[model samples]
Each structure stands twice: as C-alpha cells, then as structure tokens.
Target: MAKVSIVDVAKAAEVSVSTVSLVLRKKGHISQATTDRVHQAMAELGYVYNQSAANLRSQKSNVIGLLFDRLESDFSIKILKCLIRELEKQGFIAMVKTGALTADALTLAVNELKTQHVAGIILVAAGSVDGGLTPVLSAAELPYQVMANQGGLGMSDLIVCDHYSDSLTLTRFLLDLGHVSTVLFGGELHDPVFGERANGYLEAYRERGIPARKAHIIYADTDLTGQRQRLEAALRSDNSISALLCHSPAAAMIGAQSVLKLGYGVGKDFILSQQKYVTCFQEVDRLSDGVMDLSYILLPLEEMAHHAVRQLLQRLDTPEPLPGRAFSGALIR
Candidate 1:
C-alpha cells in the first residue's frame, strides 16, 4: 500500500502540495471552499495528516516553555510572576517548570517540554550560566532566550542586570555612612552576577583606600540556611566590621537575622544594603542603611515573548526562517 503524503493529497484536491500542507497545518491562506475540498479529499483518501511531522516542517508551536532553577527562592517566584504577566500581555500562555537546577535535570526537563511542541523557551539561569541547556537547546530547532547572570553560553539572547555600576553605588552608600570597617556578605564570586557585585565592592574599597580584608568579606550562600553559618563565621572572625553589603534581599534578610540574633541591632550595630532585580523595597518592611537600591534591571520578558511569537509566525510564512533577535533589560531603580 502506498503511503498518502502531501503530494498525493495535492493531486487528489487538484492543488499544489504547499496548499495541502497549509490546509493540514491550518495556515488559513487558502479559501474556505478550497480548504473544504482539500479536507474532503484527505478524508476520501483516508489520509492521516501527521500533525507532529507537519509541526516539525513548519516549526510553529504556539507554546513558550518557561523554566527556572529553583522555585523556593523568592526572587525566582517574583521573576516568574513578572514573566507570566508579561507573556499573557503578549497574547501567549506560559507553561512553567522548575527544580531543574542541575545540568542533567534541565536537559531532561527541556527534552520533555520539547516533546509537547513548545514554540520556544525562556529560562532564568540563576546561580549558574550553564543551565545544562546547551545540547538540547542547540538541537531544538526553536527560538529560545535566557535571562542570565552574565557570561552565559548558548543564550540566543541574554538579559542581565548591570551589576558593576549598581553594586558600586550600593557599596559606596555604605562607605558614605562613615562606616569605615564593613563586611561584604555575598554569594560566590564565581557567579557572573556576584562577580560583578564583588568588583563593585572592590572598587569602593579602592576608592576609599581600604585594604581588602579577607575576614571582612564573607562568601555566604544566597539561601538563608547556608548564609547563617557564613555570616556567623564572618562576624566571629572579624570584630572591626560594622556594616554589610548583601547581594540579594534574601541575603540581606539573613544578614539582618544574624545581626539581631547576635544581640545587635540592624541600623545601630551594623549598616546594610543589597542589589535587586525588580524592586527590593517591597521585599523588606523597613529600609535603613543596607536598604539602598543599586538600581533595578527589569527583565524584557514581554519583549522576549513577542520575539518568540514573531519568530513562530515567520517560520510559518516561508521555508527559510528568520534569525532570532536579542533584547536587553532596562534599569528602573
């Protein structure tokens, strides 16, 4: 038995193979009568239009997969909400998945999403630029964007915070408060984002002519639990430190709790501030020294979603596809 393909359908309907493909793909370029005729011919010939095959050919999946590293982090939740609202504004729905912090986990998760035929993917590759998406995303044959922490690989487009200038501004804010001896409780400097923040902190120290003190700089984890140990160790190791520069609000909270738990007040015992992606003001109930804004970079989630949609539309237009476009974030603080 001969397999009924697009050519057979076109011959049966007295139309071009392109027309049959369009009809099967529901591109809506053909007229109603022609569409009905092609469908009728397809029914008569007992032809089953392979939807997956057609989708592969056209590369038009109206779905955008939103992936995050971890869901427990407040920053992740806030970004996800912002991204969701932005995607909805662009007339697109987001199917979100999380807990894929590792490279292997992300690869498997993205592969599973690919099976569902997503138009594209948007990922917040937090804590690490290598989200284990390189292999799968490269082979995906779809438009994808990564909101990164700088120096990310395989990001068709990247949206990152301006850590250098923002962090400098925040660190100087602590310096300006007459707090000569300060502690920098931050994440690992290996991370691009945190590395930038570290640069800013170092620049402030250089400008203030303060020698880099190893004990005053704490490489605390971004999460609260890990930070508790690091902050305690830092405070115990350094008695001259009277101020703190945290990386994120979560880090700031950990520092604050540690300051209080150590029988010291936030503003009186030690001054503090942090860098934020959206707005750190809302995250904290009170704002004192460590609450200065290092400028917020609003992620272009809506624009990214629109770009993915436009790419899908273009792929549906011609055999040759247009290249993906990258968009940058804005400093709103």
Candidate 2:
C-alpha cells in the first residue's frame, strides 16, 4: 500500500492541501472543529507526520528541551510524566537532559540542547541551585521557562505552586484548632522554597498576635536518624508543643514516627499537619498508615505542569515576556 500522504488527509477531511499543511504545522488561525476533523482524517488514514522533513522544509523544529537538576524524587518523576504528555499533545517532542546542579553543568546541557535545535526549553530546578543555573540560562539567550518550587533570579517565565499561601493557610488552620504551640519541621533556612514557607508560617502567628518561638522552627537534617533526634529533642524541651507542621510528606512521616517513639499518640496526643504533592499520595500512604489522620495541603503537580507547557509554547510563538504563574494548593482536613 502506498504511504498515506498529506494530500490524502486533505481529501478525506474535505479541506484544501494548504489547510491540511497549516494544521500539520500548527500554524494559521484554524478553528478547533476544523483541526479536530483534520486530526481524525489523519488517524483514519494511518498517517504519520514526518517531523524531520517538515522541520527541514519550514526551518522550525518541533522539539522542546527539558533540563533538570535531578530526577531522583517521586515529585520530579511525576512532573516529568506530565510535561511529556502535555508537550506531545501540543505536537512537540521532548528532549530530556539531566546533570549535576551547577552552573557549568547547566551550561553544557543548554548548549547540547541548542546543538539539537530544540525550539525551546523548560528548566526543572528541584534543588536550591537555581541561583547559579539562572545566570547560565540567561547567558544562553534561548527561549526558556522555569518550572520549580522557587523562582530563579532571571526574568524568565516561571510556574510554581504558591508555597507561601498554602503554608500560611495550613499553619493558621492548626493554630485555630487550639494548637497554638505548633512547631514547623523540615526545610533549610537559606533555600528560597523553604524560606517562603517559613515566612508564611511566621505570618500566621503574627496575624494572631502570637509570638513564634525560634526553637519551633526546625531545619531538616540529611538523614532520618538526625531528623528524628532533633524532633525528639524539640518535643521533650516543650510540653506545650502539641502539634507538628511538616514542610513535606517525608517530613511528616518522620515526625509521626518520632512522636510514636516518644510514647505519644499521633492524632490524640499530637496533631500532625503536612504539605503533600497530590501525585505522590499513594507512595506516602504505603509508607505511613498514619498519614490519613493528618491535615494536608495538596500540591497539584499535574496542573502546574500543564500550565508550564502552555506558557512555554506561547513564549515560543510570540517572543514577548509572559508573567510568571503561581498556583495555590488545596487544603484537606
């Protein structure tokens, strides 16, 4: 059988060849209904678009680059999956590159992506290394957007969950529940992501005219044993601390375990609250049965990824600067 061609798709869809070409290239002001018809015709005819040939003809690539500091965590994996799916739906292919979170490594990755002729890039900075990476990305002068927990120093468009609002809401909820001495657990002091959350936690106390204790803010250690030790010490130091507000699900699990090890019931003796990514709830559930008893702020990772892809595509189409997008997490008690 002859390979299906654009002419055949045009004939089947009852549109001109040029219209089919426009639809294939995602150009022109084609109506949604017409686009759907063209897609259906191509599907029925088993048409496979030759992206390489199209790129050569038009001098515009349909490949997007995804640069990541790391992809080790479940949150990163979920974001990766969402980004791939969304990019594919927009008629673009993804080229993923991961490396050490440093200026030199990021420069190498961006240069490599440029050599491949990627249309644009989406940088995923999970760690607090964006301070160094932002300068490299800006120097590259490529069309790129950032999808991370914290915004970088550059003027690039960003997509991030509203950590400050969510943290403030969660902390206030715990305080309203009569846990005035609730302690915040996890996160580094210098990291921007954690800094926003810490400010929110403190803001909640300020709103209520309650003085926040310096000792109540506990930064997480690299290991679980160290975190457990710190939490145990905090609880022992103040009998009035009847609640724990953790920065993430992992922190919450450790806090719960520590409370139990100290002969305190999780729900009865001490309240547990945490900010959880919606996508990774199942993993957390399997890791700790006590998670169900805790109050939560749910981060919508899929929604954030969808917005990031949409914004990046828009940025590619029109080289104008777009405002950064921030989404708030949902509260669950």
Candidate 3:
C-alpha cells in the first residue's frame, strides 16, 4: 500500500502543500472550515504525522507542554505567565492545559498535551493537589519537569520553591517580634508545600525552646467561610498567639475578617500574610489590603520560570536527567 504524504493530502484537499503542512503543524492562521476539510482529507487518506518515527530521524520539536491542576491561585498565575513568556523568549511555543486536581483529570491533561507532540512538559502542579500522577507522566517517555508540587512522582526533573526554609524564616521572624506563640493559621494538610511550611513552623517553635503544641499547627478548609470559622475559633481558643503564618493569601483575608469581627485591630493583636511577587504587586496585594501590617514574601516567579524553561530546553538537547532543585523566596515587608 502506498503511504499517504503531505503532497497527497494537499492534492486531495485541493489546497497547497504548505497549507496542509501549516494545518498539520498547528501553525499560522488557518480557517476552521479549511482546517476541517484538510483534516477530513487526511482521514480519508489515513495520514499520521509519525512524531516518534520522525524524532528518530533527526528533527526536534520547538514546543513545550505546561500542565497544571488549576489556575486560581496567585502562585499558579504568576508561574504560568512567566513560564510562557520565557518559553517564547527562547523560541519555543508553550501549550498550556488545566483541569481538576484529581489524578484522572491530570492524566487527561497530560494525554491531550501529548497529542500535541510537545517536545517537553513543565507540569506546574501548584496548590493543594497531591497524588498518583507520576506514573502517567513518566510513561509518556518525554522529558518532563514538575514545579511546586511533589508526591514521590517520577519525572525527568522536579523544581520547587523552598517552602519549608522560607516558612521557617518567617516563623522565626515572628518569634523575634516578641510574639511568644504563633499559629500556622490555615492550609490544606495534604499539599506537599503546605506540609513543608507546617513543618518549618513546628521546627521554629522547637528551636525557640518552646515545646511543640498541636494547637499551633491547624489546618483549615480552602473555602473562605470555612477559613473564617477556623480563624474565629483559633482566636477564641488562644489569644496569646499574636501572629499567623498563613500558607495562602485567601487564608490571610479570612484571618483579617475574623480579627475585625472580634473588635480587634490587625497589627495590635494579630498579623497575617503569605506570599507575593514584586513585579506584579496588584495580583498579590489585592488580598493584602485591609489585612493590617501584612508581611509577604517576594516570590521570584519570573526567575523561576526562566530557569525552568532554560533547563528543559537544555535537557532536550543533552537528555541527561538531573536531580530535583528548590529555589528560595526573599522576604518582603
């Protein structure tokens, strides 16, 4: 049987071979009707791009796949935006997909990106998602890196921000401020980042000669109402703790509302904050206003994104696997 080629596809679709190539590569602007006609012609001809076969024949794809659970958090937004920008700067296209935090949902996203023939994948598993996703990702047999989320998942590389170290620094700073006790106000316990931050908080207390108190490490629901209730309850249960180490910006907002509801000022009795980016303050600072004397960390989102893109491209050339790396955040008052 004669194999179908781009020329045959163009002839069958009554379009130029360039048009067929453009449609196949998902490049340039092709009308939907024409694209459909070209696809129909290809289907009639049983045509496939043969990506794996082509890769073996000395060709490299300049596309990067970026997968994420969701894009609601400031951290997710910042990281994705920077990554895409950096990818474009280095002459690579970014294909981004997002879905629910479940393993199946993540698998679907990975599979869809796979269909696009992305050269490498940057899985931005931000937020409180943790679970069995490494298998599907590793099975893809493509160089992939996971950012900001971990679960013993197998991948080519892992990149993360140092949540534990930074959280420990923040906690120690709170202790230095004459606050005898501080509470890790709110976060999901299952998230790897949250767990690290929580550990840092405990370590800070332990190193300060204060015995670890179970009450200091409290986890809260992600919802605003649930967090507000938790904050109110925590405040009532112990007012001696003068500060909160919120793992999220939403949690900080809730804590602020709870403090106000109890007729107490922000800086006078309690302080709250989590993280932010200096270049894009509006997105991070929106939740900080009315929260009183908030001290947030400056996450180098742009720097992280640039490094991830650069590393992924280099790995594509060398195909050498590297160990996971964590970047640290700077404190911003």
Candidate 4:
C-alpha cells in the first residue's frame, strides 16, 4: 500500500542509505558487490526512482512542449520532426500535443503543459488573420516560440516562412508562363499568414496591370476536402484558366488530383505552384511543364528550431527578457 523508497532498498540490501544512493547514481566509489546488492534489492522490492521529482528539485524539467494546429497536417509533421531532432540534441525530451487552434483549446493545452512543468513550448500557430493568440500565450507566461507561422508579438520567438513575398513570386512566375488568367487558391484570409499571401496575390495582379477580381480569388476552406471542392468548382467553371497558385501545399496535391480528374494535365494544361512550405519528399515530381524546377517554397525548419530552442534555453537559464523575434523563409525553385 505504501510507495517504495530508497530507504526500503537500503534496508533490504543491508547497506546504508548513502551507499544505496551512490549505487543508484553509479557514483561515490561504491564497490561492485554493493552496487549489485542494491540493484537486486531494488528489483525485489519493486522500487522505482522518481526521476521527475528529482528533476523538479533541480529547477529544470528537461521537458519541452510541441503544440501544433493540426496533428495530421503534412507541414505540421515536418516541423515536428525537425523540432524533435533539435530538442533531442539539446538533451531535452519533447512532448507533443495538437488541435490547439481555438482560443479555449490553446488555453487548455497551455494549462496542461504547465501541469507537466515543461521548460518551454513550441507552438505551430494556424496563422489566422481573423484571430490571434499573442494575448493568451502572454497571459500564460509560457516561454514559447511560434513555428510555421508569422511572428508579431514580443512575448515569443517567431519562425515563419515568408509567405507574403513567396506568394508574389509564385504568382509572377505563373504570369511569366504567358498565362493571362490566374487564380489564387488560399485558406482563411482572416489568418495573418494567409492574409499576407493573399495580399501578395492581389499585389501581383495589380502590378501586372490586371484587374483584381474577387471571382478570380477563391478563398478555400481550412481542410483538404473543402479546398478540393472550392478549387474543382473554380477550374471547372472556367476551363480557360491556365495558371493556379495555391497557399496550402497539402491541399495542392489534392488540387493536382482534381486537375487530373478533369482530364487536364498538370504540367501542360495548368501551370501550378504552391506558395507555402513543402515537406521533403523522397521524389518530388514537377507539377508544371516549362518550370525549371518543382514550384514550391521550402521553410528552413531546422534553422528555425535552432533559433527557437536557443531562445527558450536562454530564457530558462538566465533572467533576461527577450523581444519577440521573427525568422523568414526562402523559395525553393
């Protein structure tokens, strides 16, 4: 009924508590025989050392929280992998959680991680222009970094792909392909990141002396199915549409499939380019002909993680405060 402790192991092994401690830690010049006895006694008594409790005494939990917008999203998985590898290198274990897109969900997740006594948190914000989490994270006092999302607040470190600029680049590339009519498929324009990319799309058209038509700019839904329906309808209505630029890479694959289903070839009929971050796949096929390479932007996730972890550790080690930092991304062909 009682929890097993080191004292019980020491008593059973006929050794002092100090000797048992030294043996358990593999320190203090304890003899091999005494170490063996301590181990056997521990096994016999079913004693488990409370490492978490010990870690609390040292004021470092060696735990980091990874919060994502959607667990199943492809970009989320890519960023998570990079974050895990970086955290492991720093000698910290990463605990991952997802579906923290809403305000209540984000608040609840932060509370849960706090209960676990995590040292820092890496949040993959949904980049909703219609919403914000800066106030919530600031209130929670959780040292955090924003990943796969744009940075704005001073409370956290921000690592984001330059969505606005890259969108313009992709759109211009489509124009350069001699495609007169262009359509930009995007998610919520209320999200900051999406909003930025949408602005880029509009700016590209305006610069090229093209009229900014709302009908040409289709704001897709957040998920894949919604985006597929929206894109399919847009393309089906106007078969004259020759170029398509999308902001969601995961949804872009679906768009490609939709294009195929409509008896249109991707590289030939519709020049396609995804404006958002892409995961490193084993072999990426070029979606559009005449393009020098696969049309996509690649976020530097490892570098982002390195900056985030460094900031988090600095906050943990010293008492100095840091302003919110922003990291930009690059376009990969």
Candidate 5:
C-alpha cells in the first residue's frame, strides 16, 4: 500500500491543501469544527504528519521539552499527565528528560532539547537543585517556563502553587478547631519549599498571639522507620499536642498509624491534617477511612499544569518575558 499524503487528507476533508497545511501547522484562524474534520480525515486515511520535514522547512517543531530533576512523586506524575494531555489538545507533543539535578546534567539536557528544535521547554521541579538554570537556559536562547514549589530562575516564566499561603490556611483551620498545641511533621528543614510552609505555620501562630513552640516543628527522616520513631517519641513526650499539620500525605498516614499504635483514637483523641495533590486525595481518604480524621489542603496540580501549557504557548507566540504566576491551593475538611 502507498503512504498516505497531506493532499489525500485535504481531499478527504473537503478542504483545500493550504487549509490543511494551516491546520497542520496550527496557524491561521481555523475553526474548531474544521480542525476536528481535518484530524478525522487524517486518521481515516492513516496520514502521519511529518514533523521532521515540517521542522526542516520552518526551522521549528511543535515539540515542547519537559525537564525534570526528578519524577518520583505522585504529584509530579499526575501533573505530567495533565501537561501532556493539554499540550496535545493544542497540537503539540512533549519530549521529557529526567536526570540528576546537577548543573552539568541540566545544561546537557537543555542542549539536547535545543538540538531537537523543540519550540519551547518547561522545567518542572528543577528549581530545587542547587545550581539554577538561568544562565544555561538564557544562553540557549529558547522560550522556557518553570513549574516549581519555590526559588525560580530570573529569566524563565515560573508557575508555582502558593505553598506558604496554603500552609497558613491549613494551620489556621487546625487552630480554629481549638487545637492550640499542633505539631508540624515531615519535609527537609533546609528546603526552601519546606521553609515557606514552616514559615506559614509560624505566621499563623504569630497572628493568634500564641507562642509557637520550637519543639513542635519536626523534620522527617527520608525513611519511614525513622519518621515513625521520631513521631512516636514526640507523641509520647508531649501530652498537650492534640493536632498535627503534616507537610505531605505520607507524613499524615504515618502520623495516623502512630496515633493508633499509641492506643489513641485518631479523630476522637487526636486531629490529623495533610497537604495533597488533588489527584491523590481519594487514595488518602480511602486509606484513612474510619481510621483517622483527616483534613487536607488540595494542591492545584491540574490548574498549574493548564496554566503552564497556556503560558508556554503564549511565550512561543510572543517570545516576550512575562512575570511569573502563582496559584493558590484550597483547604478541604
């Protein structure tokens, strides 16, 4: 069988070849209905758009590069799926690269994406790394965006959830429930993301004129066993601690289990709250059913993904540096 061509697709869609070309290039003011018809025609005719040939002619490709320092969390995975889906709807594809967060590794990754002629790049959670990408990405001269928790580069457009504000809200909710001695659990002490959240928790206490106890803020170890030990010890030593504000779902789970093991009723004898990606909240709810009373802040993972895609596309069109965007999460009881 012969390979299907754009002309065949144009004929089948009952549109001119130039219209089909415009649709393929994602340019011109094409109607949604007509675009759908052209896509259907291409699918029926098994016509594959030759992105390489198009790139050679236009010197650009409708490919967005996604760089990740790490992609290990449920939050990262869910946001990644959302980004890919939204990008595809706008007639673009994602090329993802994940590796160590070293400066050399990041520079190499940016260089590789540039070689692929990707229209733009999105750096997800890469700001956590020590050496920032401002110089590397600026030198590459490509339109790029950063989706991170904290500390963005100077040159890139950043899309971040308001962690400090959300944390303050969550902590205030717990305080309003009359829990004066609340403990903050999990996260690395030195991390900027953790610092913002911890500061928010502190600020809530400051607002209430309650002296925040230094001992109540406990950073979790990387391993579960260590966290369990520390949490159990904290509970045993502090009889006044009646509530916990966990930094993540995992920390909340551990706190709940530790409470139970200590012969305490979760909701009755203690209160537990956590921060969660919207996609993973159901799982946390399921696990905590009848076992713990859980309140949580829902991180705007999907919202951030949608905004990131839109901002990157706009950057591609205009190539002007825009100010960063911050989204706020909601506290759900």
Candidate 6:
C-alpha cells in the first residue's frame, strides 16, 4: 500500500494541500466543517499521523515522560493509559518508562526520556521504599510531577487520591453489613498505598469497638498466585473470617476463589469490600464468572491522571512548580 500523505488527504477532503497542512498542524484558523471533513477523509483513508517526524522538524517536542515503578500493576497500567489519552487530547504525547522504583533505575529512566527530548516527566509510585524514586527529583533537568501514593514524599506537584479515607469507607461499609471479623488482604506494607489501607482497616475496627486480630491482617505479593496461596491459607485456617477488605482487584478476585474453596458463598457467607479502580467491576465479572459481586469504593484513577497531566502542561507554560494536591474518591456500592 502506498503511504497516505497530507496531499492525498487534501484531495480526498476536497481542500488545498496547504489547508490540510494547516488543519493537521492545527496552525491557522479553519472552519469547523472543513476540520470535520479533513478528519473524516483521514479516517476513511486510514491515515495515521507521523508525530515523531513532525517533532523532528519542529523546535519544541510535544512528548511527556511517564516513569513508574512497575508495569506489573493493573491499576498503575490503567492510569498510564489515561495519562496518554489526556496528553493526546492536549496535543501532547506520553513517552513511558518503567522500573523507576529504585534510585538507580529512576536515574536511568529519566536519562532515557531526556534523550528522547521529552518536555517533562510524571513520576508514579514516588514514595515506594522498595521502589522509591524520591532522592533524584529536583536534580533532573526536566520538570516532573509525582503521583503521591498515600504518604509519597517529593517537592514537585504531588498528585494523590485519598487511599486512607477510601479504605476507611470500604472497611466501614463491611462493618455496616454486620461483619464483625474481617481480614485485610493484598499489598505489602512497605508500599504507601497498602500501608494507608492497612491503617484504615485497623481504624474501622477500632471505631466499631472490635479488636482487630493480628493473624487476620495478611500482606501478600502482587502476583495472582501469591495472593491466592496466602488467602487460601487464611480461609482454610479460620471460619471466623466473615468479611474481606481488599486493596486491589487482584486480591478481591482471589478472595472470592479462596472463599469458594472453603465452601462459603460470596455475599451470604462472606461480604467483601474493595478499593476498586475504574472498570475493575467489569474485570471481576469477567474473571470470576459474575459470582464475585460485592461492594466497592471508587478510586479515581482517570481523574488523577487528568489532574496530573493538566498540572504538567500548566508547568510547561508557566515553568513554575505548583503545590501538591490530594483528591478524595467516592463510594460505588
């Protein structure tokens, strides 16, 4: 197939090549009808824009760096996608780099983005100790913002969703359902997200005047198999565990499987509360065969991404660091 060019789009859309160029670059003012026609023509011809080539020919690049601790996390990966879309809507691109959990890894990732000529960087998991990227924020040439997961520490525009309050809400919901004995599962304590969630679970127990048993609080690895193994053991050993509070979708699904293995129903035998990212319910429904129905507290992954990108873009124009922000999420069930 011949490479589709701007000229071809111009001819198909019945406009001059210069007008097509203008529309593509978003340079000069054009009628909305013409813009729609140009877009339609491009779509009809399956024309993909060459953003890299355009950046090469231009002085300033529209690429933004997205550095994170691990690509293995579903919640973090989903946030990465939202960041890409948000930047795209603002006429920018996301250049993603993973393995920035450690100081050395962060330095290498930032250097990688610097070579790509990215305008700025967005650092996720900035407070992870086993995967901390805190020591090298201000020294880098590129401007950066941190997604302050719970107690994340950094000087840049720190964006945080209320993991503490949301976890507390999920716990309180389970308690409201008359669940006296509950287990707090998923995520290791070194990670700020899990740490905050663990605290919330304890807080809920304290508020209800119920003593939180030490054995009930289990921290598992992020992997599905590990979550299943740990949860299965917990369920097998105890029949008193009537409710579950999970920090991630993976944990919630495993909790269901473990519950079933121990001959317990999902809702009637055991109520579950989850801190869910957007669309986690669909995934749970698909994976658990629609049996893992439970209450959930919404974690605003999309909103967090939107705010993070907007903050970065604002910094690009203003070149001044903004104060950190923390957003609270709402209940879904």
RMSD of each: 11.8, 7.0, 12.8, 11.0, 7.5, 8.0
Whose TM-score is higher: candidate 5's or candidate 6's? 5
> What's the best-to-worst order under TM-score?
5, 2, 6, 3, 4, 1
Find the candidate with the highest TM-score and give its number: 5
Taking all chains together, the TM-score of candidate 5 against the true structure is 0.74
4 or 5, which is superior by lDDT? 5
Model 5: per-residue lDDT, tens digit, 1-333? 986888899999999999999999999999999999999999999898855335433548878899887788665787789889977866688999996666788789998999999888888883353326567776777777778766554534567767788878877877776677777887877767778888888999999988867328879778889988988898888766777777777877777778767776666334354222111122255435575446677778878888887676555446557677777787667
Displacement of the residue 196 alpha carbon in candidate 5, Å: 1.8
Please report, in order, the local distance difference test score of every candidate based on alpha carbons.
0.62, 0.74, 0.69, 0.66, 0.73, 0.70
Clashes, model 5? 0
- Candidate 3 lands at a TM-score of 0.66
Give stretches of model 1 more than 4 Å off: 1-61, 99-111, 131-135, 153-156, 186-195, 221-241, 257-265, 268-282, 286-333
Model 2 earns a TM-score of: 0.73
Q: What is the TM-score of each candidate against the true structure?
A: 0.56, 0.73, 0.66, 0.60, 0.74, 0.67
Candidate 5 lDDT trough over 10 residues, lowest sum: 274-283
Instruction: Give a tens-digit lDDT track for model 1, residues 97-204.
Output: 885656678777788788888877777755456635556665666655666445455544445545666666666665675556666665775656667667877888
lDDT of 6 by residue, 96-118 (tens): 77774667777888878888988
- Clash-forming residue pairs, model 5: none
Model 3 ranges off by over 4 Å: 1-61, 72-74, 99-117, 127-142, 151-156, 213-215, 222-226, 268-292
